[model samples]
Target: MISIVLIGTGNVARHLFDTFRLYDKINIVQVVGRNEQALAYFGQYSKTGSNFSNTEPADIYIIAVSDDAIAPVSQLIANVKGVVAHTSGSVPMEALSKHPHKGVIYPLQTFSKERKIDLKNVPLCLESDQKKDLEVLNRLAHLISDHVYGISSKQRKSLHLAAVFVNNFTNHLYQIGKELCEENNLPFEILNPLILETAQKLETLSPCEAQTGPAKRGDLSTLKKQVGQLKNDRLIKIYELFSRSIQMKFSRD
Candidate 1:
């Protein structure tokens, strides 16, 4: 059995805790965090505490805190013999350099406490300074996920940037779509089929090949009409910017 001490009580930590508890091979030794209220959630399942100086001995210490807090939190467990890994996509493994056995276990998916995610489908990116630690992390990752990858810190940074463009920026665009639908006295759910189809198309078609719309076709009249329909200056600018970017990308093809 692989014993784990999970640090942090945020979305990622909560999701991991919920998933790990289901597996018989994994034993959650303790969960440490600064917030007493957040710690209470984990207290029901395992040992919980705010004191980082005195933590339970485990085979792996997973720090699921924010990127900025990773360094300081890692320092608190520098003397541990177990592998110290941070769950961050953009932050480098060196953030846990204080510990001799440092690594990264980044889950490439957006996490929310309310949403139940099938971690088996979520991609797990693993990196470690030590070979033995990597093996251990691989074993743990495989227990929950089928899609596991060995990613370098540099590659992980690039992947994270791409994720921002695809996930975060795309979600903001969806909000804009929702507002536009509301203004037109239409339900935002009208776009659900289009959104689903677009996502499903990626399974077989490359993003460039999946490209469509007035912007990609270079339909100036349609584009102008669509831009003119928007009353908000910010929305108009965003629409124009995206249209120009899409046109520029496909024009070379």
Candidate 2:
């Protein structure tokens, strides 16, 4: 059995714990956190501890805390042996320099407490210092998902930035859609189908090939109307930027 311990109990931690629990070979030794209430919430299924000393260590320790907390949390577990990995995108493995063996197990997707993650579809981006450690990560990842990538610290950093653009920025656009719907007295449900269709299309078609909208067709009238109606300067800027980019893509030789 591969013994493992998880740190933190936030959205990412909860999602991972639920997924890891499904596999009998994977053992969650303990979930550690400073907050009494948060640790208590996750303590129901497994052992919980408020500090590293009280928590029973395992073959692998996963620090699933925020990017900012990675360094500090890692510092607390510096003396522990075995492979210590963090589930962060931008943070470097050197952040856990205190540990001889360190790596990343970053899942490239947005996490929310309300949203149930389908682990099989989520790509587990894993890396490590030792060859044997990588094997462990690969085996662990395969247990939860089919799409596992042997990504490095540097590649993960770039992918994280790209995720910010695609997932984070796209969600902001959805928020903009909600604000627009409220302003125009329109029901937001109408956009739901469009959103689903756009995402579904991406599974089969390249984004460039699947592109549609007034910008792609060079519809001057609609573009002008939308630009004129955008009360938010930032939204207008984004619209203009994407419009110009789309026009360039189609009109270019």
Candidate 3:
């Protein structure tokens, strides 16, 4: 079993730790962070401490901190004896170090402490300085998931950008829907099935093919009436922008 030392105790770090417990393929020897107090509770089972700076390395050192902290944290991890990796979608693999066996093991999913990652289904995007190191990453990935993909840093970044639009931006729309429901004294849970169905449908149909709306149909009367129903100024503006974009995309005029 690969001995892994996980760094960072944030959302990603916490999720990865739970994944280790679920898979049982890797021995999580330690968890490190810059803040001692922050990592204290996690140490109850595994070895944990402060100091992003490396004391000793195991088979793998995974830095699952924020994207902006990637380089600075890696630089602090001195005296690493094994392959080092980070979990970030947009960051490049080379940020680790040219001398060390560096790689990126970025999981393409939104992680929340309350929501557990179904490791058997997560798609891990991996890249490395050498083919052999990639094999190590692939092994670790396949231990938890069958959906490992070999992606270049460039493609990973592109995919990350697309994810921001689909996941983050789309969730904001859902929040707006929830707010509207609350104002109307409707239970937000009422939208759960609709949301799930919308996601399921995209698996079979392209978004353009699945598109269903007054905007897509160019129903001018319905579109105008729907905008009039929005009480919020910002949402009305957003509806206008999206409507224009959708119309332009479909109509081309």
Best by TM-score: 1
Ranking by TM-score: 1, 2, 3
Name the 10 consecutive residues with the lowest summed lDDT in model 3. 46-55
Tens digit of per-residue lDDT, candidate 3, span 1-253:
8788888889888888888877567888888887776686487755577756544558778989988988888887756777788999999887886436889898889998788778678899988878777888888898988799989999999999999999999999999999999999999999999999999998999888888898999899998999999999999999999998999999973
Report the C-alpha lDDT of model 2 over 62-129, residue by residue, as the tens digit.
99998999989988887787688999999998898887888889988899888999999999999898
Every model's TM-score: 0.97, 0.94, 0.93
Judged by whole-model lDDT over C-alpha atoms, candidate 1 comes out at 0.94
Candidate 1: list runs displaced more than 4 Å: none
TM-score of 2: 0.94
Window of ten residues with lowest summed lDDT in model 1: 38-47
In terms of lDDT, the best-performing candidate is 1
What local distance difference test score does each model get? Answer: 0.94, 0.88, 0.85
| All candidates in order of lDDT, best leading | 1, 2, 3
Model 2 per-residue lDDT at 229: 94
- TM-score for candidate 3, please give it: 0.93
Winner on lDDT (2 vs 3): 2
Error of 2 at 238 (Å): 2.2
Supply the global lDDT for candidate 3: 0.85
